[model samples]
Target: MGFLQQKNSADDSIVARIATLVLRLILVVAIPLIAFAVLYAGFIFLRDGNAPKWVITAVAIIWGVGGVAALFWIFNWIVELFSDTWRARLQPFVFVGPALAILAWYLAIPVGRTFYISLFDRDGPGTGQFIGLANYATVFTDRLMREAFRNNIFLWIIFAVPLTVGFGLLVAVLADRSRFERTAKALIFLPMAISFVGAGVIWNFIYVVRPPDTEQIGLLNAIIVNLGGTPRFWPAHTAIAPWNNLFLVIIVAWLQSGYAMVLFSAAIKGVPVEILEAARVDGASEIEVFFKIMIPTILGTIITVTTTVVIFTLKIFDVVWVMTGGQFGTGVIATQFYRQSFIARNAGLGAAIAIVLLIAVIPVMIYNLRQFREQEAF
Candidate 1:
């Protein structure tokens, strides 16, 4: 009787484990399916409903965040239901799966599709000739494209990047020494709060010109008038060609300076105070200490900041679109892409330009990843 009882007990224990395993599997599958159904329904409602804009926005935000959170929770809990050995093997993939899926769907797939479309002629992917490298040849050889590349590389990048980074570094250093560091940083960083289009609009008022003797409504024109100077159309006239481009570059610099300042400030703050004191002890002036000690210490952050800004400058569009509509020699690569793709309806050429831009960004991205990995190691 005792032997039979012990055997039965062992069988019962196995049954319970099997039941638990089945329950865990069921929960994993069922939870996600139900969540997906609900999410689909909500998306449809949001798409079709005549609800108040704010109401739709609020619902979308809540559903988006809550749904993702719940899905992650369900997945993690299911993973945790496994034995220690299984859990360890599965947890990383479970947590990382969603992000991988998103990147594959949103980034990798789109890039591949864009490249595929680039091979076709103006009618785009559905019905266009496979032009081989002809579109790319045109991209390089075209007049407007050539001008766009020149403006992007020289005026937008060469001029704006240094000004933004330099001004940011200067502000970061000065703010660090001041008692009102936070306040000063806040004020300087305010430009970053405004959207690029908004900044363009604000600066437009400053650059807006009037008749030479008329009441100058533009702040810049007013100042010029008061100071016994003249206000020309600031974006259109300086010496005819690329000088107008400089004003557009200035807008980008102004907008991005705050971004650079924030990054530089954090990096500057992270420098070991002892090193600065030691440099001073070694007869290094403030200038020498800044250039030698402080800069070297935060070189990684500097590279990161510069690369980030360079990427942004490469893709600049809204500011130029809003202010000059890519007129008056202000067009860059992005604006040129917009003109080709949407404006001119030259889909093939646009795709080639896009591919070129992507190629340009790829090296910078790889370098940035390397820098990030090195920093992560530390």
Candidate 2:
């Protein structure tokens, strides 16, 4: 009788464990489907725009917020259902899966579609008949495309990378030693708060030019006229047309300098003070200490900042679009892509330009990743 009782108790425990596992599995599967269905129904009602206002609000609150919470809860419950070792292995996936799914849907799918669209004729509809490398060939061989590439290179190399990095470093170093460090940094970094289009509009007034006989309304032209100089269409002067790209570059640089300054300032602060003191004790000048010690120590940050700016410059559109509309020799890869795809209705050409821009960015991104890995290892 004692043996039989012990066997019955063990059997009961096993059955309970199995029942719990089944219940957890059911919940994990069913909850997400139910929550998504509710969320979809809410979205449809919202889209139809015929529901009572209060009903719409209630549906949004319940479906959107509650659905997200339920999905997260389901994921957690799944991890909890596993044994300790299994739970440890599965927990990371449970947490990370949703983000991965989102990236695949939004990023990966679009990139694939862009590539697929690039292999067709510009005039053809709906992923036109694949013409292999023709679009790419035209992108490289076309005159306007070549000029756009040149301008993009100029922006990346001359203005975006070097000038922004240099200005940022200069401001950071100066601000660090200033009596009103916070105020100075805040003033300089203020430009970063403005959007590219807004900045473009503000600078447009600065660069604006009217008839030579008329009053100069643009701040820059007004200053020139006050200094007894003739007003000129600064963006369209034949002598300066090629370098007008530099004007757009300057606008981007102004906006981006603040970003670089923040990063560089942080990196400079991270340098060991003892090392600088040692260098100074050895009779090194401030400039020498800065060039030899501070710079080398923050080289990684400089590269990262420069590469990030390069990528931004490569895809620059807003400033050019708003200011010159890609006219006056200010076209960059991004604006060209926009013009080709939407304005000119050349989907294939646009996709090719986009791909080229993507290709240019990949190397810089790889370098950044390597830098991150090395930092982590250190």
Candidate 3:
């Protein structure tokens, strides 16, 4: 009789646990489905212009925030339903799943679509015919595209990466012990707060050119006129092949240097004071300590900052587009992509250029990831 009673108690406990799990599972499944259905209906009402303004607004806020919270709670509850080992395995997935799903929906799908479009000749939205590598060939072979590619390379290698990193390091070293360090850094970083378009507009005034004999409104030309020199069209003068690109690059450098400065400053501060004092004891000059000790210690940061700036430079379009409109040999890969896709209405070529840009960026991204992993290992 005692053995039978113990067995009956165990069986009842198992049944109750199973029932509890079933209830949780039902809530997890049902709540999201119902909330999403209501959300979809609300959106339909909004699209059809049938709902009152208050109804639409209320539904949007409640469903958007409340629905997301409810879904998160459901996932958390589901994770808790498992045993310790299972929960440990499943918890990470539950948290990371939504973000992975979002990336797939927004990033992966669009990249796939762009790749598909790149394989075909697209007339507006319609894919006209399959052209295997013709678009890519045009990108490589065409003179304008080649120039744009060269210009992007020049910007990345010569101007953007070096100047930004170099000036940032220089400024960081100079300002590190200065009395007005914060103010100087803030003023240098102020340009970064401005939008690229806004920066372009500001620089446009700086670079503005009027015909000779006209009152030189531009800062550069006004100074030149005052100095008794000609007010030349700076951006349009193709006589300076590729040199004109430098003017556009200056705007990007001015904006990005502050970003590099902040990073480099942090890395510089992180260098051990003990090590610096030891170097000084060994009679190392300040410049020698900086070059030999400080730089070697922060080599990873330099590379990281350089690669980051290089990636931005490769996709530089706004400055080129806003200031020069990609004319007069200032064309870059991004502006060319815009011109091909929207301006020239050649979607296939534009997609190819975008793919190329993606390819160029991938190596730098991989290097950066490796640097991160190496840092984690340390």
Candidate 4:
């Protein structure tokens, strides 16, 4: 009975503390707002056919600065004084509540809306009707959409994985502790610092075309012409344009290679030197040591790097968007989503594409998390 009474007393104390803190918070916010309202009302009442301009200016200055000061003072006072254990628990919500609300309002709500719209046959406007799997069906069945999806899959399988992993591994191995490591890394990482749109524009200049009779201005065309090959319209030719997409992929690879290198180099260094010396005593070739020893040791890191690149590849949009605008068969999923939703005004189709992207990303993310957890286990 005594213990029960103690528990009841504690609950009542917590409730009272909560009530007091809430009242303090209300007063903190309300005082400045009420003052501003009262001052504005007085300003309105005292307006006798435009009294002296200085008087009006003084009133405005007083209310504006005074309101801000009062708000700052009250908020700080509440944070300093009323922030006991109950208030501390509530205080974080005070700060984070608006951000959480805004995130739900903007990001979470839109993502949910996109998923909902994927189920309907809506363009940018009214929902024409419920069309369960029709939009997803059209995404696969429609020629351009199908081609875009194929190209996106190709980007991930053919380009994104190799460029980010193979080249990154190669560079990391080559540049590790080399004389020009810092300079090499800086040059490689420079492209990543450029915005996607900016990198696309730079590559656009490289892939520029001139008439056959005209002097080639594009670097690639100029090189080809100087080598006695015909100067072709690089961006226009569908046959060659997909390979040109690889060139854009190169820019991204160049930027991301440094990141991969930094990670792998750290992993490589973590390999016990004793293991390398033991392999050397066994007469393993340097190449064999790298392939059999270093790589096996860093398999987890390699998988982590590869999966990270895969996610980026799945979402590759800006480069493709800026350079090709989903034209010449260089479309990836993200760009396709934008093209469908905004350009084609097909929200349903766009949402389907987004869902496909989400599906693709989720597994890769899960794999990445698993790899990291396994590495931690090791």
Best by TM-score: 1
**Models, CA RMSD each:** 7.2, 7.2, 7.2, 8.2
Model 1 has an lDDT value of 0.85
Please, what are the lDDT tens digits per residue for candidate 4 over residues 65-157? 776567555554665575354454445544554446557666778777877889877553364567888888887888877777676667555
Candidate 4 Cα deviation (angstroms), residue 28: 16
Give the per-residue lDDT digits (tens) of candidate 2, residues 2-95. Answer: 5433232334466665764565455444555566687887798687888788988887888798788878887788678876644544455556
Candidate 3 lDDT by residue in tens digits, 289-355: 9999999999988988987888888889888999889999889999999999999988888998899
Query: lDDT (CA) for every model shown?
Result: 0.85, 0.81, 0.82, 0.74
Please list all clashing residue pairs in model 3, or write none if there are none.
Answer: none
How big is the RMSD of model 2? 7.2
Residue 144 C-alpha lDDT in model 1:
83
Q: Which model, 1 or 4, shows the larger TM-score?
A: 1
Query: Candidate 1: misplaced stretches above 4 Å?
Result: 1-38, 70-94, 227-229, 372-378
- What lDDT is reached at residue 17 by model 2? 57
**Candidate 1 structure, TM-score to reference:** 0.82
List the pairs of residues colliding in candidate 1. Answer: none
Which 10-residue window of candidate 3 scores lowest in summed lDDT? 3-12
In order of appearance, the predictions have TM-scores of 0.82, 0.80, 0.79, 0.75
